[model samples]
Target: MRLELEKRPERSKIMAVVSPIAAVVATLLTGAVIFAAIGIPPLKGLWVFFLEPFSSLWSIEELVVKATPLILIGIGLSIAYRANVWNIGAEGQLTAGALAGSLVPIFANSWQSPLTLVAMLALGVLGGMLWGLIPALLKIKSGANEILVSLMLVYVAQLLLDWLVRGPWRDPHGYNFPKSVSFDGWQTMPTIGDGRLNWGILFALVAAVALAVLLRRTMKGFEIRVLGEAPRAGRFAGFSSDRMVVFAFLVSGGLAGLAGVIELTSTVGQLQPNISPGYGFTAIIVAFLGRLDPIGVIVAALMLAVSYLGGEAAQVALGLSDKAARVFQGVLLFWVLACDTLILYRLRFVPGLPAGETAR
Candidate 1:
């Protein structure tokens, strides 16, 4: 006997909605087992890893801050994926954006005005779009695989940022450190109150609402869905796949870039060797977890943000490794994909049938 997967004739609408919830439950159970294996009480470990993040006002604020970047990046990614354009180089685009946005503060340190902040934000989005455009053009012009090209560019962007920070952009007054001059005055994002929460959260909320409108109430959204679901039909409808590809990449890259600049200005306050905590990569999971819906991504982003806070809290409270958060994220993604697969396909056993052969 052998097991095989058979695609369902029609996907169940109910299962589609339940898939993410099932994945979350499965992840929690698996996390419990992992905690037990590590010699920590499962209940205690789970509390620290999940529930503890919302126990205080400060932690809640940090959660919002963490979720902001995820929401922004996830919204853009949802649009790209909807159009069947896989732009995986968001991390690179984010780095490029941060680098471009930092130019104003690093070189023109004396320039302080509201317009200065506006320029930096604009530059951030432009930088990301430019970085993303490379793969789009290559794919359209030369038929190159976007996945490979975009992923490879991430390392290039990282190396470029590393060189700049370690060499030209290093802070002169500071003792040897891989960082640029600190941003001040209008260079940094303004906070709502005395807490760490900043205006970046508002940007994330606005992006989600805007994209929700774009995807549901516009012709462009119809094109994206049509192209993704049935490219032949989209062609028949006179939608240009090439333009869609460019649009997807530019939109996703720009959001990622915006997130990067906001993170630098609001949280870090300067350019550093490592500015992101893998927000771009994490946002991919966020996009999928939200079922590629912009509004859903907001909630999903907050869920993932808990893991980041939990990771830090676990280290201090439970003596867990800093990498614990990544492990949880990986398990969550695995379960999510698994559940989604089951939603669209059923498992069958074929007795006395050879592998790769269907029962007649």
Candidate 2:
């Protein structure tokens, strides 16, 4: 018998919550098999991949450091995706934010003040908004596909970053390298403890909480949800679809930009081409894994952060390349899509025609 998917009258709410957990469980099972095939003890390898990272204080701090940007970016993406804006260029927005935020530090290298920090944050948001608006305008005015436009912009941002670091932004006094001069005390982010943890973690948490409130209680939030779920209904209710698209993209881009600046000032302490290790893209997974809720995004971000820490642990212990995060994310994304599909549809077996049967 063959199987076919039949549409469900309504989506399963239980499935919506359970799918992310199921995806993680499935990824662990798959990882175990892959580890065993690679000659590593399945339990030991899995242990290293998942649990070992949490066993140390330093590791926990590192997780927060890694998760900060993910949470920030994911929260923004949650807003955009919920509104059906389809903004796939957060990576580009992030890069643009970093580029704009770094301008003050790069050119005014000697200026040392707290205001520099404030300026960076503002410029970062503005840069991201401008970059994000391009596709929004194109889509609204010319019926262009935002998905393609945003994706292509990623390449542009990356190339622009590469050019700046290797040329103008490069430190003049230091040895030849494609990197900027390290930030001074005023330029660098303040630390919470002895470790590399910064205030950005706190910022992430606050933003998530604020966004959660905005989405759950605000009239704009209601508008966004209505427009996303049923545009026809939203219009009948007097909401403008075009306006929501712009609003969603701007908020998304602004948050992503803020994340970029935070990563620069708080973590990296300088502008570099490799500032983000696909945090923008990985955040897409985080957003879905969180079910597009801000608080949920925080949880999802921490889980993904564990993958980064675990990858490092696996590399150190098993001498394996640290691709744990990427692999886990890919599997998780696939499973999320699968679960979402199944939530809206049920599988039914279809009988095949008997071999003896002949067409008339």
Worst 10 residues of 1 by lDDT: 351-360
State the TM-score for model 1: 0.95
- Clash pairs for candidate 1: none
How accurate locally, in lDDT, is each candidate?
Answer: 0.94, 0.88
lDDT of 1 by residue, 205-270 (tens): 999999999999999999999999999999999999999999999999999999999999999899
Candidate 2 residue-wise lDDT, 247-300, digit = tens: 888988988898998889888888777998899999999999899999999999
Q: What would you estimate as the lDDT of candidate 2?
A: 0.88
**Candidate number achieving the greatest TM-score relative to the actual structure:** 1
